[model samples]
Target: MMKIMLVDDDRTMQAILKTLLEMDKHQVVLWDGTSESDIFAQIVQEMPDLILLDYYLRDRNGIEIVKQLRQEPQTSHIRVIMTSGQYLRDECLEAGADAFLLKPYMPDELLRLLHQVQQNG
Candidate 1:
């Protein structure tokens, strides 16, 4: 099972994703999207196998975050899957996400992508 860190601001979405991921036998680590908590630090501490990053966060931009992650040597190789309600797949990929999922995507799609990323990694 992969350790997946979920970075999203919506509580309902968080709950739904946590349930879905847990059911798939993957460990889920929820980030509250608080600006006070250093994102990089949490990522390093968790050492998650993958990161599910939401595009439009409350305080920070997920695209920028992904760009930074790719730039950092310690975090560059970590797989990231970006999600957004808008059609920002190209931007997300350019920012270094392993994959992009549009919002309201089916649970099966997410799980499929998760496994696909693992396989490709």
Candidate 2:
């Protein structure tokens, strides 16, 4: 099973994602990385298999977080899947995200991306 972290400010989205991922047998960690230190600590310590980062946080963007993750050797290699309500694939990928998912996507779509990441990487 994959260990996935969902970084989103929306509690509803977090709950839905947790349910979906858990139903698929993957572990989920719901955190927005609100405090810079929290995300850094969690990523380095927990080292989840994947990070489902929202494109826009209340205070920051996922690309910034992803960039930070890439800087740390311990977290650099972890696959990060960025989700966005808008089309920001280029920007997210440029910042080192492994994959991009548009918002309002189906659970099957998310699973398909996860499977692709696992197979390719």
Candidate 3:
């Protein structure tokens, strides 16, 4: 099974995604709130197979986070999927997200994306 890390400030989103991903048999680690520094550090320790991040983080911008992640040799190869209710599709892609998923996505779509990431990884 693939290990996924969910980084979002909204508790509801984190919960919903966690449930959906878990149902698909993926191991999920969830992080909520605005502590990017701590959260990134934790991610380094956990080293999940994939990362699903919100476009707007409470502490730092999602683009910045992605850049930082890509800069680190250890975490650079991790697949990152960015989701947002506000950003445009191209914006997410341009920001270095491997995949851009809109908010309130269907479970099936999420599953497909996860599977694709797993397969590609």
Q: Each candidate's lDDT (Cα)?
A: 0.91, 0.88, 0.84
lDDT of 2 by residue, 40-98 (tens): 68777778999899988877788889999999888898999999989999999999999
Model 1, TM vs. native: 0.95
Instruction: For model 1, state the Cα shift of residue 33 in Å.
Output: 2.7
Give candidate 2's whole-model lDDT: 0.88
Candidates ranked by TM-score: 1, 2, 3
Return the clash pairs for model 3, or none: none
- Candidate that would win on TM-score: 1
RMSD of every candidate to native, in Å, equals 1.2, 1.4, 1.5
Which residue segments of model 1 deviate by more than 4 Å? none
- Residue-level lDDT of model 3, residues 1-121, one tens digit each, is 8899999988988898899889888899987465777878888988999999888887676788888888899989989998888756787777677888887788888888878877877
lDDT digits (tens) for residues 10-121 of candidate 1: 8899999999999999999998566624887888888888999999887788988888889998889889999999999999998899999998899999999999999999
lDDT of 1: 0.91
Summing lDDT over every window of 10 consecutive residues in candidate 3, give the lowest-scoring window: 31-40
lDDT, candidate 2, at 29: 83
Considering lDDT, which of the candidate structures 2 and 3 is the better prediction for this target?
A: 2
